[model samples]
Target: MHGSTPIRASRTLKKSHANFYRAFHDYFVTHLPSSSLHPDSRSSSGPHHQLPRSASKPHTPGEGPSPAPLLGGTRDTTVVRIPLRSAKHHFGVSVSRGTRPYNEDTYQAGVIEVPAFAKPRPLNLTRAPANSPLEAYRAKQREEQEKDSGDGEGTSAESASGDPQVFYFGVFDGHGGSECSDYLRETLHETIEETARKYDLVSTLKGKPQTAAIVSSSSSKEAAKDTAGSATEPAKGSMPEPSISKASTLQNNLLNSWKTTVGGYFRRFKPTAFASPPETPTTSTVLTHAFLQEDLSFLLAQLRLSTHDTDPVRSDAPLNANDSLYSPTHFPSSDPQVKKSFKGGSTASIALLSTPTPTPFWHPSTPSTLYTAHCGDTRILLSRVSDGAAVPLTTNHHPSTPSESERLRRWAASFVTDSFGEERMSGLANTRAFGDMSSKRMGVSAEPEIRRIDLNPSEYAFMVLVSDGVTGSVGDQEIVDLVKESKTPEIGAREVVGFANEVSVEGDNATALVVRLGGWERRSEGGGGGMGTREAREWRKREAVDPRGRMT
Candidate 1:
């Protein structure tokens, strides 16, 4: 009788959920345009009754149709919401608890808009007199300016007035516990922005010339060379003594010209030190490493402060009435009593999609470039219609990797593989991660591998960021094919998580983030699978040997 009662309750809950879904769907369908509705809802003879040829047929796994052309040949394509069964495009996300008591996987996706007014303006330097000692210097200055401008064309007023949007997505997988992953989800982006701002300021300062000093030195050297070279061969009508005076005069003129130029450049550029710069530029991998290190240090300091008292009650005291003693901020990194509480660590994988500045003229509609930074085993995969396959954007970082295993051995850390056949470093599978203070002394690093890829809007389809929970159970190609078969990104994400849960025996938390790279378009026809397979393989091989290349 008790079992029957629970079964009846489950049926009732399912029915209620179904009713709610149906009501929401009906409300949503009513808001869409009449033409976007199902054919039965629109008259057969209506002007917009016919569906696009690509949408008419159902897409099979790994058989995505060619993408439809971008409306008006630009990224400003219209997004039409349709019924779930007919939906063809939408960004989606899925987070599943799987069989874990607590889910430690987290993902985020959103657009960041940067206004044109926020962009840096070029400096205007004073022109030097023709044939003056400073003429070569002026030529060099012009060359530098041109190179900085890229393509010698400044941003147009129209482009400057418009706001460019960038999409960012990331996946974080926590081990031991979810504290570190949750903390990163809240603060990593801001930290990256701060680091980028510092880098930009340093770059700007380094680029600026000590105009007067440089010009004076160069002018003096050139004048002395001329004086020495001309001494042996005096011109037919020129006075030899006057030539020396002329060289001195030329040096003086160059110095004066440089002073004026420097004044003008500074006045026009107004290069003031910014307290903060906008977060658009790709962040250096070192910044990621430094940020994690600093944050961990700060946490450790705070924890030390909170637990300095030797008294059991005082040392374990909570920060507030509602807060727990084991909260990330209060839990001491070194305290053995709370090791289980504070030992949690997490892996971070971030993908930043940013619009290039001085937007390329040839491809004015160029898609945003993708920059990725990862530590641990979470993966990023790019699906390209041109390739018709999934391409791995990041390699997993675990003890299984030769580099990681060698590093662990060098550190002399003791660990044993579990029943799952996974190698561990001081009981941690990931060789690099954030907040593994217990293993930090054992050589687990916070450094991340970074990579950059220019996305072509025409051929790019979508990108997936997933935790190992998904990759452990599903193949890269299978994930790509599943996404291709789904009508929209959201559905694709849900399907991926669902598949991972079904296949994974370990019951780890599963999370997937699917980001559409371009506007809704039908998949192209007759494209070969895996366009950059060879290049990707070569890149992985090279990176394994030297993971620190170009990181900073």
Candidate 2:
């Protein structure tokens, strides 16, 4: 009777195990589609038979049940029956047209491959002519390119180590129409790269005082000779000078002498006279401002030219379309009728991350850097995993801000209060943007506020670039939390977009780009202990009270 009792207990245990397996199988089948299951398992007749091949084999009494069958089989044994998704389509973008008739928001995020030859290098002006600043500038640029090419790190290094990748992300918000935003989405990065390269060359030339002095002296000498010749030759019906004015010549010689003296003193005292100084944001900021302003001006000019050609009435009409033909002061129309051509303008917010390569000149302590240029309401936020904080890296340029409001008032721009009590710059919510030629006269600028942040791999976690649509609906803490919780940047971006669409305000478009930084692995390494630190708690408390305070 005792032997029979042991047998009955064993049978009961087996039954319980089978029941548990059946319940798990049923839940898996109900929740996960057949496509998510292995093909062999899908064909099995019952829950027991649906077990993986490894589980089908018998297990010894002392050994644990052969590792429980996974929801999906191992990669080698099982094929992923699900269709593959492209990284560009999946990881790159997740956007939603919210309540707006059309999505006026445009965004771009991608890895840009930079060739070894394209890397920035110091220009050598050693062989540049002592005179002719423009010639010296050209020579310096040529020498820099030649030096870069001579480094012998082009194709071989690129093939072995792969091209250095620069991750670029941007969001453009269009107010009146999508044309300007669309245009910017396609060309802004290229414009920035071009502007930066030009600025680098110009800044390098400006840094060399000796070369500049030489050029300036040459220019002064040439001016003096021209003045003397003009005075001697005399203009038609003009009186000739009694003696060739030596004053201008004498001043040029004295200026040259002073410059030479100063140059020699600096060269003798400063050991690193030729070394390039540490980079600053001033040059980049100025370049960004100039590029944006010039691009907008070019767009306006093109519109005007096109309008002048297309409109026969304007072409044949007098200079001032509003003035009568008999008006005495009538002049040819210099400005184009671009207000009608461009109905809307866009706000541009761009972020660029440059990762250093393993070159001979590369410094081990020098970290990757992030550059941001913004002109509108879109935002860039940095999350440092060490502190568990969301740091706003941009300020929204709107008339609601005191500084912007003051600038608009100085420009004599008409302002109206909206339903939300926000001041509008000539009926536009944003004070700075590209296009909107009509509002430009009222001081609507396209000059971007550029910033640079050095990325420390130990502290940096991720960056978020988003349009106002997302910001309007989501708080900074919430965004950081969502991204922190996500397993991957692609998933994080999708989740953020989904959340924004779910709770976004009416008549807005939502877009988000999540960039995972260098120290993402540190989060997993810390096992959540990092987030529990005192500094992290403090950061969270501060964020809760005022998320937008530091940002504004």
Candidate 3:
């Protein structure tokens, strides 16, 4: 009888697991908005074209139901699979078109390889040249590459070991159409890597205190004089250093140091210097430049095509119509005029995790750095396993913000309010986005706000990047909590998307990308799955109104 009890317990556990999944499947199919399930129900002409029935299977209400399979069971066919090259890094992505006829959300995740010759110059008190940092870095990289190829040596940094690797993840939310997002999905990361190689090629101030500041050659004399005059007192007219408390954590100390170093190296120097201090190239600057340049390029290509239709010379030119830039059929057109013009825009939230190679220049105990570049409302959140805290790394860029509103006002851009009372800049919700040629002239810029964080593996578990579809409906902490108890990152991403689909009234296209960091697989005590999720609460409320429809 004792042996039989053990067998019966194992069977019961399996049955319960199966039942839970069955219930989820039933709820998902039943609650799915009718517009998504029935193609004819949606308008034939609109920004969102109806997806083919073959794109996804729609389970009609009251029809025969079955347990959803693991991978193939999802309705949307737009799920992105990670490449085998990036498999070493644990990550997962889930993308689906909910109530919309087509999915405009897209994501990219993989490893980016920085050039082996890329290394930051050693820190020195002496002022550097006035040349652009990007130009100088490129010239040096070219010379170093030639020398390395001849001698078969790596980076010039003394005792340097291997090349640094960057784990790159990005999610793009498209409005107007998916063309812009699709183009960004294919090209944005490449542009970032190219820009990083030219501008942020080196790891600056590694293995040393970040107190040293790089100064301009012209301000060297005044800077030295000010430094000699004051240990505690400020010079006649100079920016004062921001105070740092001893009680602050190491992370906070590093952050303050970075701000002091980058904000103004000549903090104690006199006023009447040249114009302003030369900008120092860093990851943030690199990302900002990449976003702006990419946006400009996308807009230029779109505008050129839009005007080329009326240009007789362009029509008769020998250019290849199949070329990516010239091809009108490359992406679905959202324009009503059927012109070859590309009319779409997208919001981007990108996170790059940079880990130094095993080199003497970098300390063995040094933590990886996370650099996030954000434009528009897509979100990036970091989950700390130590205390189960959710930290948002990017701020949403909307016209409603004071700074954004003021900036738009300066450009003489008019604002419009949607039926939902949401303010928009020239008919677009986001004040910053990519490839909206029309809005570009109306103060809609692609300049991304950048944030830097020193990632402590033991303290941080994972990072999640989601499109506005998920963020619009789920709270940051709730999203992190939902993933906390998942068995794997892939399952967590699916659950987040599923929950967002259920909560959203318009059925927006949803996407979630989870990257497992050092603290992944480690969970804070007393944290796991339960019935306390937002979806569960909503379900309970619905059940209260219809007791007969309740699930056992």
Candidate 4:
């Protein structure tokens, strides 16, 4: 009876949601001001002078059949600095971790299944403010780089020759106005990359490759437990082959992985944190060594520096997070309260590409990198154009994953539960995301499950990244099809966004960014565009567009 009730309620919920979408789609936007096309102020940031399109003429790397509507609207914020250490340790390690604004009302959705060949990566890195000096430097470098790599030289298609090419693209799906998505749009990729570099994950992965350790640890732990009994011997009829790496008794669930590594990163350990203003404890060098006994010497050393302790709540200052979004920390400051008086957040996915490394048994052609990160349903879809089929790139993280929920179940240990004494379950809320910090214990995960993947140059057409606005109502497969089917990725992207918006309507701010091989063209000489006669600028200023341009 209880199960039946939930099933009925789910159906009703779906019906209501469908109705809402239908109504929203039918209602054409009214009062769509140029300012609506432009941006309003931000809770955490200042306004921008102009959009990217305004600063430079777009030299589309990939072109397609049509140029649909362009998504506009944005806000800018101060440059964010993510610890280089964290990013490297947690490559493809999920959460584009941040100090998210604490809030309630929020919305997000999308699908993600990492490319089989590629491991999951936290698609996040630190970002510079829209117009900061660092931003200026980076932008200048890109212009020079693009000119050298993309100028009329016929080799545009393979611009990424052997050397690492920094590519930028993002899908910012906004719900309550384009604020959150726009913030992400302006700052997502740079943040992800910077964060990734910090952790120096390439070294971390090599030091403790997740796979070999799991196989060895499980074999050791379970073998000890089963020595007396419960060891299901190999079927006499089918003897097991002699492979050095045997699939042990461990369940292929994410939780088991936690018992060894992941859980430690999330929880507070006795690290040597630097002292605050209050009476700081002076730690003698000898005492610190004892604390470092458990391969956590580095961590303990850090703690001593800061009066370290577990329980993030007890900290004098909050766990270090993005500088701009610094509301959640426990520290008291003279800094004026951030004017951003709104409650909102976003579900984001981030990743980093790495150089190939050698593995014990497997001969991988590409870098065995980590994608430690969290995300909304907004997924990362990877494709290898040579095969002509889109491939899954990372596991879709949601409240639905039993393993993810299990981690939370353990976390809820001290809290009271049902009459039957079962631990309370906060499973339905997404297990990981960026903006849903208010729902941290329930709706979000502070830690991200870093997955690994290899990038193979031989078989990739590039990746297509989008937010829920683009994929929620529209099928994920359809978006991939659009990208692959189109002649070039730019048109493919524009068409994909247009179609997605057409299906979901204005309420869902949809955006698509494609970073792929080329068919790039030089910027159109800024002049009277759109055929010989009616100038493009005059047409917009006077609503006097001529249909004659459509003729030729």
Candidate 5:
């Protein structure tokens, strides 16, 4: 604070305020109608899209010519969601997390990737006509694919069973270490499953359960270990799973019930599931695929050990316990028994598409769930086709949020300084993350602000979820217009990524993943969460096509 001259300091403060304005620019957006669609996004290779808003209505599922849903699959307790567009598809992502190296006041470096998700959708992907720019463009796909085909490849069917066709895919950007990222990638589904199996019973608690309570008061003392605010809580793995209340688990139960309900739909109405003559769609339609990205980088501690720390948070665990992401050559451990430490962590935002089952009728040709997490600012900036205009779908968990600040206040009562207390950084080094345990002691949390959106006609068109890397300088509503004004989702992603990079200062790892889903039948009574009349008719049309969401 002392090194700045008066004029320089004034300018610095001005830029900081301006940056914050860029970070949160909603009031500036002009209200627009939903009918207008930007033409540039579709103008093959037209400079990356950059607009503030567009009034585009959600695409009606079956009524118009549209792409299929970008993702599909089963919904149950075992599902974990991330939003990471694949490499080949027209997907892009942007990431800018962490305090600046010299200026901890702002984000330094960031990463941005295009066409965030290369998901399989209902559209046809037969080499875009002939002589198109894409056909003319060249990349070393052959060599890359061959190289990536080996073991330990970033993508393998290690956990995939039956088909690797993802129903949903997401990105995990880690800051402190890859341990947390790896943990989520490997066990998110299991965690979801466990949460579902154990948590569903609570939802059914409105009535007496068919079985006696396994987690009773007799086990309350035992339950102390797994409780939310346990002072002497064990590490994640060591913590016994006696069970507790949380949203993730709630989602698990809801999914399980739906599965049971659907299974019954076929069993009770065997004619539909086991018809004799079988059924065929009246028309022919094609399918395509999409993909998203994830952030699995060197950890801070690992960086520290190797000139950077090898590992930071020391915990006795099974996998990758000591597989330090960064190298810590010096510095003390933030937590004892570990290598060096870091001041902060990273967050990963991914949006993936996949097929959960073989049933047809869904739009994605697959099902997709949006996965947005924050560690070091690689985020998925998505605006829902709400009432045709863009409505923010993801919540940025920052220090300024009231509830978040409250949680920290309670967590950091004894540790507060005169200024910069836990309360001061609610959205600042706040709760929920992909990394940053250092912030966690001040109660840096890891509760992701996740949502499962079954693309529907009502919530039509696709969305663009950029990171602070993109949105930081750009206002949220401004981003809405950029995509809305664009002609295609692909172009929109590229355009935004470019603009974000230009505005970004030094030390920013800016990455962007843009996902434009084709045809989404918002969950109606049958496949969607609830049935809207428009959504219902859309489903009926798909039933005319696939039946389950697709044709058997």
Candidate 6:
């Protein structure tokens, strides 16, 4: 009787939700601003908005069945161009608890605006002697700027490529408990921004060109290398001089100083665990520090909370009501049964989008770039616009991988294959993750593998980040096909998660986060279903499950 009550309640809630959404959709259409309305809708003045002619008009007997409506059953292709990072409509997220008792997965999608690191003044080397290497380098730099400007190749600092906006999307899949994933969803991005700001400030103070305007592409790396190389090489039309190497040494010192500053920031948090930061820091280094540092901090916090040996109340002492020691929530537990249940681990898949400036209404001046930092088996895939093909942005970190096995050997840890033929390191499938303090000492790392992709709108349509629940049941190409054929990102995300849950035999929690990119809505001449043939076959053979987790 109790089980039936929940089932009945679920049906009622589903019906109510459907009615609410229908009413909301009607109200939104009636209240939409004229400027925001479709060209077809603008002609109608009444609160009752007219459907597109294709959907409203009856098909004539011989009119070739009339034109079918676009993907979402309307001809309106008008999309508001907001900052991609903060635009809720442009991003879609869906999660299903599946057959799990409770969900341990967490996700985050948002923008980080780094105003402090947006702009930096150019270093002034004019005061140096004419014969000095610094003066020669400055002259050559000015010459290159003139050449670029004259060739109409100058890039504006105010362009999207130079914008201090960072779009962050992350999925954390937890095992054992949700505490570790929850902690990361709350703190990781903020830590990254703080570290980046400090890195930029120190770079400026040490006379190294700041990275604010150059974080867009590999071009930034080339620019920085050129700047450093100029210090050692003789400037064009300048004779070889003894001071060139001296200037180069000065540049190296400047690089070290900035690295030192970043290192100091991490040391303040975990002085013993993080004794040294990378000498040459980049985007990858920043992600690595944030992941490892946060993991250590989280483990320490869990240890303190779970290993409490102090008495909750002292009979001899008069306790104030305001004191946490007297409160049930904060009172320490002296029970010997208190175990380290909070030492759960979570996989992290993070993507940072550096968008290119859109000019003349939706046409980008340059291609956008994506940087992904990932650990464990959570996957990040890019769907190409040309043929709707899947492009992998991260490889899974499993104990079965050759590189992972070798690394485990070095750390005195090895994968153990169970009777079921599943390879595990310290009883965990993934070799790297955010927590699992016990497994951490046995070579379970929190270090993420970083990857960069240059997203050309003509080639790439969208990107999806999915936890292992979805990846385990669905193929990469199948995921791309599902999102590609959907009407909108929200529907696409839901379909991805729903399909995973439907086909999954184990019924693990499933999550999908889809971010629409420059090439969104542009379909290929060839259709989509061809790539997802295998998944389609599997789906057909499986018993269909209803939304409420019952066989249909």
Question: Looking at model 1, how many pairs of residues clash?
Answer: 10
Compared with the true structure, the alpha-carbon lDDT of candidate 3 equals 0.57
- For model 6, residues 502-529, the per-residue Cα lDDT tens digits are 7777889899998877677573433453
In candidate 1, which residue ranges exceed 4 Å CA deviation? 1-90, 111-163, 201-282, 289-302, 305-341, 357-365, 524-552
**How does candidate 5 fare on TM-score?**
0.39
Please list the C-alpha lDDT of all candidates, in the order they appear.
0.51, 0.51, 0.57, 0.33, 0.34, 0.56
How many steric overlaps are in each model, in order? 10, 0, 1, 69, 163, 0
- Give Cα distance to truth, residue 400, candidate 3, Å: 1.3
Weakest 10 consecutive residues of candidate 2 by summed lDDT: 209-218
lDDT of 5 at 439: 48
Ranking by TM-score: 6, 3, 1, 2, 5, 4
Instruction: Identify the leading candidate in terms of lDDT.
Output: 3
- Encode model 3's per-residue lDDT on 1-552: one tens digit a residue: 775665566566656644432211101111123355445654775324343444335544332222112121234422112232233335667888998999999888654544222223333455447597856765565566446533222321221222443556789999988888887877777677666545433343232111123221113455333222212322223223322221123223323432343223112222211112312333444465567667756765676577778999788875554443354324323221223567778999887665443221122233566667788999999887656778897777788887677766766446788999999876788888887666665567676765556654356777899998998877887788777767677887888898787766677999998777667656444244322355664674476456476545
**Which segments of model 4 are wrong by more than 4 Å?**
1-163, 172-338, 354-372, 410-429, 505-507, 517-552
lDDT of 5 by residue, 395-461 (tens): 5555555545554555555333335453344234434554443343455543333333444333444
lDDT of 4 at 250: 12
Tens digits of lDDT, candidate 1, 169-272: 67889887776777777556545544433332122111221111101001234422321221122223322222334333433443343234322221221101
Which candidate number has the best TM-score?
6
* TM of each candidate vs. truth: 0.54, 0.52, 0.59, 0.38, 0.39, 0.61
Badly placed stretches (over 4 Å) of model 5 are 1-90, 93-164, 167-343, 352-386, 414-428, 485-490, 503-507, 519-552
Query: Which pairs of residues clash in candidate 2, taking residues 3 or more apart in a chain or in different chains?
Result: none
Q: What is the lDDT for 536 in model 2?
A: 49
- Pairs that collide, model 6: none
Which parts of model 6 have CA positions greater than 4 angstroms off? 1-89, 114-164, 201-280, 309-341, 358-366, 526-552
Q: State the weakest 10-residue window (summed lDDT) of model 5.
A: 283-292
Give a tens-digit lDDT track for model 2, residues 1-552. 775665566566656644432211100001123333443754456344233443222323222111112222233322111111122212335688887788888887653322221223333545646688867766565465445434321211222123234456778888787867877776565555443333332221112111111010012344222211211122233222222133233223333532343232212221111112212212243334344434445455556555667777766875555432333233323232332355578888877555333221112332455667777789988777566777887788888776567756756446889898887866788887887666665666665665555565456667788888888867876676666667766787887787766654453788888766665544334325234343543464565457485467
